[model samples]
Target: MSLVKKSLAKTASVVPSSTETHAPTAAIDVAQANAPVTENEQKEYPFFVAAIESDLAQLKTFTDIADKASYKSEALKRNDYLGYIKRYRLSGQNHHNTVLAWVFIWLVDLKRWDDVLELLPLMVEQKQPLPTVFNTKHWPAFVIDQLYDDANYYLSQSEQAGLFTISFVLHRLITTVKNQDWTGLEVVGGKLYAMAAKVDASLHNYGFAAAFAEQALAINEGAGVKGLLKDLQKLLKQSEPEQAVDAD
Candidate 1:
């Protein structure tokens, strides 16, 4: 599908199903539909479409309508991309997670971290997971508390998938440390240990020269790192820690 079409597809998922099945009054260009998809297509689809094609303009309107509709979960299940579709549509009764996930992906992709904070409260109102950025110093304590409240809510739903990249988590960790959120050091300490254990042990050969290590420890007095080591020590055989003892 075209980038615009695909994004519209996701956006359509959120629009109320009862709305007119056509484009809103907005004029869209047919020629733009023929534009190359090389740029947005090369990567995995972003959570939001950047521009709407003329043909798909009506679809965007439908999505806005769907966002306001009240639909039964069963009705939503009939759609192909149920998660995406249910996000913007339905009355306050919907509990879909797609909207929050898409919003996070969208904001992160746009590098609009501040705006993300603004949208986060709405997500919380809907009982969704908060983005992990607040776990670090990039945002204020009030923001972190709000984000953590949401994280705990989602964490109760399932053990975090543990699928986030160590680098992504570490980058945010530094932000938390920069903001003097000492508590973040402990929270991220476990994630670092988990990442180190899963990553190639060759990382130890580089010792602390690893980019993530430098970024995380730049502000920390190695205490956070030492805690990380202690966690890794529990997971590894004694000999591995012995070999790396000099590295510290």
Candidate 2:
């Protein structure tokens, strides 16, 4: 067997299946029965948590993006544990899974946009919490903040291609989080809308740009979109066909 299969087999022997249940013969047993995490999860959670902590500590040592990317590449090679955890969660089991959370964050950091999008809906459905290091209460807000920061970074570098790439993911994220309220939604969400507007404006898609800018302004007056909106409106007006004057 491969190393991953071997580790999984060993762990499986110790971890109880989700369907396994014990008759509560005492008060302690009753309390155990009511515990949120299954025996399987309790057994498996720590291994993944320890792995995530080690990865985070190692990641802190790298300053350059290339170094961090290389570290992530190496770390992802040992991520077979995630498959087991994902299966557990997808089987209607709900508990804090730091492994899944970190994987999502790392995927975002790596700019694996499609993978991130694929995982986002499941995370939202499971109501996954961000890791404590992020100090964010909700995952949706954290995602928007990350994407907004990415947009600004690309804009600062005058890298339109980067912005264009990020815009697609940003739009999908916005759609996913639409009507979802979280802490700092007005600020971060508004900024995201503003970023989308700016991107569309850069591409001369003035109509969509105006709409996004309006949404940003509506969400947060300080979203810094009023100037952009005015410019977009003027351009839209200039694009309108002038009236043909009849013979006087």
Candidate 3:
């Protein structure tokens, strides 16, 4: 067997082992669900397994190709990487799960947070299984699994749904900070804080954003959230005058 094959077999064993150790019942349940297939989902099952199994070789090619491209400007490089992936997809079947997993790892390694947010759902859905350490499978599995929690947490707390949450929040945060958008900052900040608190009052991200909000408000002194917050407050004031005033 090639190194890749040996590593995958090793990974398959370790992933289930860790799960069994940590959550025995859950692991058993998943193992049963993940049992060797019958005929159903037959068309896609092999594809899924093949894609998962191909991680190391695929990732090696991806890195070798991406490194030779460009890494100058973040935006330019982001666009280049995205374009390269798109071209790769066009060249063959749209094995989006594989692409999603690789692209997320690439973007995260690049510190291209904007790109990561944009591609996060695809990453989440790919649901790559964890691999052994220093192996191609390891990072994707960790990212997909951890983000499953992050996403579920985001949804249970969100008033809005789908395509809007991460994209909007990501853009809003970056924009607000970049332009010194005090009102925009407050508005997005408040919504995120409230939503996060609803999910887990103890969530560290929530605490950080809340503290930052307090600082932003202090910077303005008496202005209050001036941009989107102001508009939201106005809407709320008109809609629920009593509640709005009380909140203020």
Candidate 4:
């Protein structure tokens, strides 16, 4: 068997059975019904699984930057399949839908941040299991790691423009994770706050940057934000006189 198939088998064991009751949620529009799976859905499910396997195999071979960029085009082609899975979830069908889980992961991989946010609540509510290749069992941790990595990449570019986008998405992600109380791997949540601080600092939002840095330190003393928080505080102090002069 290919590595992807092996990983899929491993992931299958962790997925909750269809008979399991979903965790209650009041925020997302997904229903809480026990609707039976349609015959058409049952018939079509295997094709989606096959497609995912094919895509995963192709994804494994993409090791270069140019090859990686193709993920956006590939991901777009899967949109129709994603829609079908979304409809299944909305109908209150809670089961081990690998198609739904993989498509969500692909959206994140493609940096389709807004689309990922739209689907995040329902994914958490259903307690979806990530593909084993990611090495983390919790989706929240995976998400934070992805955002932090992206933030660092943009920071390395020394361009403030990319940081602005990361800041916007990270803020919404942090809010969604907190509001939903989606607990994940240890210290991961603090990383999100620290990245938020870094991104905001790059964008020159000193006050907001300081606040996020402080929050990161509060969450994890070893979050490495102590120096960042100190710098932001100094920046804040420096800005105060300018604000006062402007007020005059």
Cα RMSD for predicted model 3: 16.1
Residue 77 lDDT (model 4): 56
Where in model 1 is the C-alpha error above 4 Å? 1-209, 222-248
RMSD (CA, angstroms), candidate 4: 8.3
Residue 75 C-alpha lDDT in model 2: 73
* Candidate number with the higher lDDT (1 or 4): 4
Local error of candidate 2 at residue 15 (angstroms)? 13
lDDT of 3: 0.41
Of the pair 1 and 4, which is ahead by TM-score?
4
Q: Write the per-residue lDDT of candidate 3 for residues 1-248, one digit (tens) a residue.
A: 42223433553521111112343376665555555542322233243345434543544454555552333233223223354333233333234344345445655555465666555444434444432343434332333333335545566666344324443443343343343333534433343333322332223233433443444455444334334334444544465777677799
TM-score of each: 0.24, 0.75, 0.27, 0.77
| CA lDDT, every model vs. true structure | 0.38, 0.73, 0.41, 0.73
Runs of candidate 4 exceeding 4 Å displacement: 1-37, 61-65, 68-72, 180-184, 244-248
Which ten contiguous residues of candidate 2 have the minimum total lDDT? 15-24
Tally clashing residue pairs in candidate 4: 0
Q: Write the per-residue lDDT of candidate 1 for residues 1-248, one digit (tens) a residue.
A: 43334554664533223344664342333333334443323221333334212322433455453342322222223222223322333222334454344444444433344545445445545555534544433223334343334344433454343223332333353344443434555444433433332231223423332333443454344424455445445545555777798788
Q: Least accurate stretch of 10 residues (summed lDDT) in model 1? A: 68-77
